[model samples]
Target: MEVAVRVLPEGLEPIASIFEDLGTGGVLIEDPTLIARYKDEPGDTQVVSALISGQGDLPVVKGYLPVDERLPERLDNLKLLLDNLFLEQRPEISTSELPETNWATAWQAYYKPVAVGEKLVVKPSWEDYCSEDGRVVIELDPGMAFGSGTHATTTLCMQLLERHLKGGEVVIDVGTGSGILAAAAAKLGASKVMAVDNDPVAVRVARENMVLNNIQEVVKVFEGNLLQVVTGLADLIVANIIADVIINLTKDVPRVLVPGGKFIASGIIKDREKDVQRALKETGFTVLEVKREGEWAAIVSILGE
Candidate 1:
């Protein structure tokens, strides 16, 4: 069932927190006037719009829970559990309609081969990219998923993988948006590569891309949150999610990594690099190298002894 709760004026935060606590999916919109107000008071309670299923006759509670009900306490505990399940913010673009100008072809027009590192070249499935002597070429189709090798985050992670991944190693790619990293690992001769994501749409897209690259057999795709569905230690673990998620995954990540195994992380803006590094250190990971490009940062760390 879908239920929508719109908090007017300055209520986005509280409303968001409420839905987040309830484990209900929703959207938050900012009108022009509120956008201006947001600049002045960014912390103003969030305006939330929630979508609930209509079949269920669940009591619809609106507005903040009363202080005396002890409901807020329950919601707070739920929020703590959900903090690891949901993305902090929804995507900026949520529309269902695609532009009619044939974005697939248009995007393809601008798409070109990307050189990830000295030995690897990431090429669009439609284009032919000649690999230099001893270099490997990874062909991919961006599709609806996020990574396509153009973004600095993906490139940086690929570079890290190229340098760290030895042939026939087992690799796990958490939050494998487009399956690019998993596919690349297979191409680089990793015997077993598993790519997993919480989003079913991402999983579908990643599977399709895996087929496009003809590595579906080597790269298994699964749907689940983080390491919950992934078992056993890996020779390498790559997580190219945002800083917050990386921080959250620190403890679980080390448990899934072989002793002295490497963890490569990206999708971190430069500003949050230190926070991620600190989280890794606290979780028993030693930072081995950090690479920065413009405002983005990627870290290569090892599981501590």
Candidate 2:
């Protein structure tokens, strides 16, 4: 089953994250800027190419799910999630039976190389990128999960990581989707890292990305909820999850983070920034900085000011 949503380009990832949460096997983004760039003949790929062609400049986010007996229920849940996406009006949701081969065909056309922070460049494993000017490139194939580092939420967190991490600090990545942040922490010089995600599919994809980056030994990917599987204290904790989850995560952050350790909370929708800030402040964290990019914000704080 292929699920498609027409969304504003800036708001793409939030909707993508919902499909991810529902255990999508893969996501194929349709960026409107390249209508002329990709043209499929009227055939197997016609569904995808047609999807890409229309809509003028509006981008379409697509996710793949197995056409199983459980698909109807999953679709219902996905629709529910989409309906609550904090938008002024509900966006359109469309679905169809997609061929497995079309997944790669669409991915190649839209998933281009993206650079995050000063030196952290996220390139797809199939894409080629030359590392220069002190760039630290993390090769990844974020199948099904949302942490591709292209989204503003993930980008803000990566940029914050570059600024805050000095070296050799213990780190924790909550909701470690695709393990991108954990890979960033290791590449940025964390000594040891704990990467946890509640979703089994995300955990598997993250571990694969770790191996792709060859940081598996440095960053451990495990299946666990926000902080349940966390054992030891960490010098820094980065979470690129939503505002409600981030707000709920505040109570346990200080417990697992070392004294004065940095906490980077992202995946926050702009409207809920103050709500999250108040939650963090109530939990005794002093907000050090907040970085905003295209309708998303990341809050950087410490255990103790």
Error of 2 at 150 (Å): 1.1
Clashing pairs in 2: none
Over 100-142, each residue of candidate 2 has an lDDT whose tens digit, in order, gives 7776457666888787868789999998789876789998988
Per-residue CA lDDT of candidate 1, range 1-305, in tens?
A: 22233233334555556555565445344344424444445453333211222212222223223224555565555445434434444212111323455544577788898877787777888887666676787778767788888889998988888889879899999999889899888988899999999999899989998888888999999999999999877999999999999999988987789889999989999999999999999988899999989999999999975
Clash counts for the predictions, in order: 17, 0
Report the backbone clash tally of model 2: 0
Which runs of model 1 end up more than 4 angstroms from their true locations? 1-105, 132-134
Q: Which segments of candidate 2 are over 4 A away from where they belong? A: 1-66, 70-97
Say which candidate scores most in lDDT: 2
CA lDDT scores, all candidates in order: 0.76, 0.88
